[model samples]
Target: MSRHLLLGVALLAALHSAYAGGKVLMLLQSEKNIDRFSSFTDALTAAGFTIEIKGYKDSSLKLREYGTWLYDDLVLFAPKAEGFGGSIDQQTILDFVDSGHNVLLGVNSDVSEAMRNLAAEFGVDLDDRGTKVYDHFHYAVKEDGKQDHTLIAATDLVDSPVMVGGPYKQPILFRGLAASVPSNSELATVVLSAPGTAYSHDPKKSMIEPPALMVGAAASLVTAVQARNNARMVVAGSVEMFSNDIFNSQVTVNGASTATANKDFCVTLTRWAFQDRGVLVASNLRHHLLGSEEQPWGYRVNDDVEFLVDVMEHEGGVAKPYKADDIQLEFIMLNPYVRVPLQHDGQGTFSLRFKVPDVYGVFKYFIDYSHRGYSYIKLTHQVPVRPFKHDEYERFLVCAYPYYASAASVMAAFFALGFFFLYHK
Candidate 1:
C-alpha cells in the first residue's frame, strides 16, 4: 500500500509538470534523427515549455487525424520539406495560429520550394535552393582558424527590447540563407539583417556580378510576423542559429574573440514567439460629451467630444499599462475626416479632445495603435453625427435680416397700389 501511494504521488507530479510547462508541438521536416533540435527545445524548456517532437510525414500531422489544439504553441523547424507528405496543408497551420496560438518557423540551407510557398502565404519569402548569405568581410572564424564567410554575425536585430529582452545589442551567429521583404509589405518585420558587404549566392561559384536584390541590410536573416489575430510567427533563415553548437561556440571576428549571444537570443525569442511577452489589450473604454456627465443623444456638427481608453500590456501573466508616445484617434466616415493624436497622462489613460467634423453622417471613432514588438490595439466606437436640431438653430439670423425686410416692403407696396386702384375706380 505504501509503494502504491508513492507511485500515485509521482504520477500526479508528472501531470502537474506537464500542465505547468505548457505542451508545445515541434515538427521536423525530415524523418531523420532529431538530435540537432535538442538544444532548440532545451531553450524553450528553460522558459517553461514541454516540447513534443514529430516528423512532418507522421500520421499525426493529418488534418483529420490531429488538430493543432493539442498543444499550446508550435515550433516548426522544417527547412527542407519538398513534398511535406501529410494531410496537414498550409492552411491548417494558418488556422492553428488564427485561433490565437503562436508558431515559430525556421529554415536552413537548401530552402525547399514548398517552404517558400508556405512562407509567401504569410508574406515572407525564403531564398532559392543552395543559396546562403555569404559575408567575406564580417564572417566569423572557427576555432580551427578556418574562415568561412557563410557563417556570419548579425547585429541588426530591430529595436525591440520587449522581444529581444536582455542580451540585446549584441551580435548573433547565423550560418545559412537570407530573404527579402517587400518594401510595402507590413506583415513581417526584419528582426535580423545581414551586413552591407554581404551578398546572398552560392558560396561555391565565383560570381561575375553581385546578385540583383536580396543583398546587404535588405537581406533578412530573421523576421517576425504578427498575424491579424495577434498570433505571432517567427521565421528564421537559419536553423543552426538555435543549435547547441552555435550557442556554445566562441567566434572570432577581425581577430577579436567573443562569446556568441545566440543563447540569450534564443531564450528571448522563444518567449516572444509563444506569447510570453509583447501582448497588449485595451479595456475600460469611455467616451462622451467633453464637459457633461450625461451621454448626448447625438453629436451635432460642432460638438465638443472626448474619447478615453485604458490600454495595458501583457507580461509575465500580468496586464499593465503600456506607456507609449503615439496613439491616434480617427473620426471616420467613408474616409478619415479627422485624425488627431492621443495624449497619455503618465498612466494608461489615453485621452483626446476634438470638435466633431462639420460633415454629419455615421462616423466611427477609430483607434489604431500598433508599434513594433508589441501587440496591436484596434478599438472602434460607432456614433451618429447629425445636423443641428430646429430648436438648436440660432433664434435670429443677422445675415438674412436685410432680405426679410425687403420682402416685407414689397408686399406692403403691392397691397397699397391695389387699394388705390379699387378706390379710384
Candidate 2:
C-alpha cells in the first residue's frame, strides 16, 4: 500500500511539473526554414516548454482569446514579415509585454518596419534595412580562403553571469544586421556587442563614409530589456545564430580553431528571456521593535526597529534563496530618512536594524532593487511614526533647571514676605 501511495504521489508531481512548464508561441515565416532551429527548439522542449509554431502571416493566429493571454511567451522569428497577421500587431506585442509576458525577438538584414518599430519600443535601434554588420578583421574564415565580413565572430559579450551564463570561452558566430542600444538606457542592456573592428553599413557598397551608422563596439548584436513590470525581452540581430549550423559550426580565431558558443549562449539567452533564471521575488516584509516579533501598529521616534524580508530567486521552477550584497532598505517620508544595506542570513531572510528617525510623520519603508538581467523588486510599506507623549518627557531636564530654580526663588520670597507681615501685625 505504501509503495502504491508513493507511486501516486510521484505521478501527481509529474503532472504538476508538466503543467508548470510555460507555453510558447513562436511566429515564423513560411519561407524561412524552421528545421534550421531544431537545436534551439529541442532545448526549449528539454526545459519542459510547450512550443506552438505558427507562420507570421497566419491570419488565424490569436495571442489573446477572450481578453486572456493564451501563451506565456512569444518568439518572433519572422524578421522579413512586414507585419504580423490578424490581431497580432505592434501594439498587440506591446500589450503582451505590458501584461508581464516575455518575448524573444529576432531580426536579420531584411528586418521589416514593424519589427523595427517593435525593437524601437524596447530601445533597440536596428541598422537600416539593407545594412549588415561587417567586421573586416573578425569575419569567420571560410574553407575557400575567403571571408564574408557580414558573418562576424563576436566576442564582446556583456560581463554578466546572470544574463549570459558568461565567461564565454569561444566567440559566438553571428550573421545578420546590427543594432544600437543607448548607452544611458536604464531599461535596455546590450548582451552582445560587435567587436571594435566591426561596423554597420551597406556591405554591397564601398567605403565612402567615415563613420557608419553603427560603428565598432557601438554596434550591438544582441540586447535585452527588463521592463519595469519585470517582463523580459531579448532582441537578436541574427536569427540564424539560433540555427543548428551555427550551433555546430567551428570558428578559427588567429591560428586556432574552436567550436562556436552560439548554442550555449542562445540557450542561456532564452532562459533569461523566459524568466527561468535571475527572477527575484521579495516577501514576508516585516518591521517591528528590535526584540519583538509582533509588529506594532506604529513606531515611535528613535526606536530601534528591525526590518526583515525573504528574497527568493526562481531557477528551473524552484525557488531558492537569493544571494546578494547590495539589497537595501530605505525609511522614507518625502525623502529617505535612513537608507542602509540589508544583510541576508544565507537562507533568504534579509534583515536590517536601524533607529527610526527623530522626525515624526507618516513614513514608508521602501525597497527598490534593480539588477541587470534580474527582475526588478520595488516594494513600499507605509507606517506612521509617533512622537513621545507629554507624560513620557524627561522629569528634570538640565536645560530647564534654571527656570525651575527661578520659580522656586519666587515662591520662597512670597512666603518670607507673608511671615514678616503676620509677625508685625
Clashing pairs in 2: none
lDDT tens digits by residue: candidate 2, 1-425: 69999999997577455334589999887736778788999999898788998889888888999999999999999999888778888888899999999999999999999889889998898888988887778878745556677888888888888888868888899999889887789999989999998888875778787554588888889999999998999999999899898898876766577788998899988988998888887888988898898999999899999999999887767778998999989999999999999999999999999999999999999999997878999999999999999998899999999999999999999999999999986
Give the winner by TM-score. 2
Q: Name the lDDT of candidate 1.
A: 0.80
Worst 10 residues of 1 by lDDT: 59-68
lDDT of 1 by residue, 76-109 (tens): 7787776545666678777877887777888887
All candidates' TM-scores?
A: 0.81, 0.92
What is model 1's C-alpha RMSD? 7.4
